[model samples]
Target: MARTTDGNPERLAYNDRVDRLRRKEYRMLKGTTYLDHAGTTLPATSLVTQFSHSLQTLLLANPHSASASAPNTSHRIVEETRLKVLKLFNASPEHFDIVFVANATAGIKLVLEAFSGHDEGFDYYYHRNAHTSLVGVREHAASSHCFASDAEVEQWLQDEHSFSGDANTDRPTLFAYPAQSNMNGRRLPLSWPAALRSTSQRLRTYSLLDVAALVSTSPLDLSDHAAAPDFTVMSFYKMFGFPNLGALIVRKSAAHVFDQRRYFGGGTTEMITCIGTQWVAKKEKRLTDRLEDGTGATHSILALHCAIDVHDMLYGGFSEISKHTGWLAKTLYERLASLKHANGRPVCQIYKDPAATYGDALTQGATVTFNISSSDGAWISSWKVGQLASSKNIHIRTGSLCNPAGMACALGLSSSDVQRAYASGFRCGQEADIREGIPFGMVRASFGAMSTLEDVSIFAKFVQDHFVGKGLLNVDDNDEKRVKSEEMRRSEQSSTPSFEKPGLRLRPVRQQFWAKFGACIPFRSRRPDVVSAH
Candidate 1:
């Protein structure tokens, strides 16, 4: 039996089971630390196996065909998977209708397109930390508003309370926000969805919670029907690590919004005139049938069932996954935050609340975004760090990370400054264009259920050796006291927790993970604390 750090048999059995799954999993690319789980995950080994087994045993044809038994099988599978997805979110059939889409982007587009076809205009309010897909919804709105921070968002809603619109004459209003920020892994208030419905009586308020990032690490409880979002968009691949698929969950009351769909395809209509003049859409349109434009990604939908099964087997549930990954993120954050130069200047600047506790799942996810600085106080290039990490097979992400507003806030860039940079060729995926002294971006390292403490230690050791002075290993006086206190608190918290928490155990470094970086440079007794570029 594989043993945990504590040598507890129950924990050992749990780790052993996970280890077996990890060994069977073929998706883990060789020699990569894969610190970019926020981007995508490695599918479990059994996901593919289960999918193949289903293919071999069941006859699944196009779900649109009503006359054939094979189509019936396909239909049944699709419905079952839909329920599985709903159950995964703790959503009920009476409250939410699932619409299949290409991915989360497609899901958002569907809602935007349907809403934009309204005869009346709409007021759109979105968060600054929203993903690019959510940001695109502004184009479909009559008027758009943005809030840079949670405080700003709350204040805006509060100010709007006094203003009354003619409910009979005014257009509907929609609020869009990511449940969790994809850039820095900040978990926004889940209560925002229900609050919007009650925000104003004079306007029809609907909310879309983009759960693309949130579902990866934790469960989104739509079980509270009263508090659920009008629409929720998510990509399954982000959760299962394979088979790109997405869903748009529409509240039953909001299903009428999809009646505005201008175009119909394949199975979306009931009858058509012979002269291509008039068409009759299904009068009692099924929620999904109206929104799913054409033939679905059948194979991917089939794979989703297996993915959920594999996910549950591996991690028990999101709660366990959340606790484990939360521990890893806090550990990594604390280590990076505690680093300093000989002059006591922080070696890194983290773009998150410095006071976030280790086990707190409310404020953050398993993602850390930060920038390292030279002892001289000049910012080191995050792109360069990513490149170096890549050379060592430590796969991470860098640059603005597709959240322009979040990036702007983190880097203190003005709108004009961002526009100027964009005009000058600064963009996502072009991190190489970043010249030295540009003060461009921050590095991001995000973990998942699959990550281990050795991953954190290896990363810490790398930053320690390459980015700070050897003498800087000693914690400053103030930091020393803080570290001691944090340690005491962590010890107390972990002692009573039922699950085996990660990051509490120190293991031998995974030397192979850093082998390509060459032998570690000897620590000097005393040297200029400048971060070496070499």
Candidate 2:
């Protein structure tokens, strides 16, 4: 709930502590400042170490025989990881089934395929801002509807006239929604899910939550909410661990309803035979194996386990992490407001109410978005900011970030306009040329368990200074070298070449060389290797 004051040395000192920790935690580039935890987080040392150990063990074992020697070890690691995930979500082991998949998209597909095949004629509902994977399923489903708001959902359920009577008319419905959006970092109301559950019970429908972003932060009482929904999906990568893995938690009573067509061949089947013989499916009660149709990413799973363990220990558990992230978000929102451009305009246009407490705004999680304003010639596109941050050794992501629906809804921009803006290299609404007006995407600054208060202040100062052209915190000679090299290339291209062999032959060899090395040279480089030397 606390606010950060600009030029407050106490807050700046706190930010410095976070920066130091980040340098240690991520081995970031010197002078680089990372402010983009929402897209992904740097892996903790524990996670990296554990991941390496698992990989080494797998590599050491002989081909086609690793499982034989390390069967129990592999299973133990997976079970332990699952238990960690269970603890994070506060779900019981018996009711929750954890099946590791490639990613959130894969998990969504598996669930959609299973639920859609039932021929129950159950209506599928989702928000307009639902993830693409869920959106695709909704589009494909025979009976599906998307609601713009909570009121729309209420109206749809009340109107029996909208429903076509069928044998499974009383069957439960499926609702898909994200806990936090990747685009704007907007946290959807938790009350919405509970309300959906209540509506589902009265109307004999079911709700399935896509809690991919919320798994690391949001607190849900599974016991009380279990009956309302048949399943929930979560992703491991978004929480600062391994990539390419997700899980689906299904209730015990509704487990039988899922029809399994193995997407891949391995571990999912109990037995197999050829020549008109049959393969025995894995036990129904063992729901994890039901959906885990392929060989597991044992190493990545181990990393995920390590991440969760380290997350609990260092961040004072998920609850404390959530609190820390909220504080950081609040600090960022407040500080960014004080940033001014060279024209004496606020650099950031924050959308949320300034008076709102961190707890009020971040009840769902710590994700916030705002527009960045810059001078005419001194532009910093979101993409450019991401690139600049990366050049400074910071890791951040920018752009619509695969959430066109949310961008459209929040900014009132069409999909084509958003695409064009990115293609044209504009960062926000204020940055775009009015004559060539285009809808610009919002810049998101997200925080997580590993984020410190210092990260917020450093990033805030960077934005403020960058807009005013007072020299960014981490700009180096390399940037000037790049500009100079570009100028040289343009000059060379514009000047006519001296042709000894006069067939008007284009200088292919020279052109190729220039093209390759043109961007590599720094603008102020005394020698080409000088830039690389640093």
The candidate maximizing lDDT is 1
TM-score of each: 0.82, 0.73
Give the lowest summed-lDDT range of ten residues in model 2. Answer: 512-521
Any residue pairs clashing in model 2, and if so which? 15-454, 32-392, 173-205, 173-206, 480-523, 481-522, 481-523, 481-524, 482-523
| 242-287: candidate 2 lDDT, tens digit per residue | 5557778777666765653434366666666756876565645477
Worst 10 residues of 1 by lDDT: 509-518
Which candidate has the top score in TM-score?
Answer: 1
Local accuracy of candidate 1 as per-residue lDDT tens digits, 196-247: 6674562467888899888898877889987898899998888888789999
Q: The CA-based lDDT of model 2 is what?
A: 0.56
| lDDT (0 to 1) per candidate | 0.71, 0.56
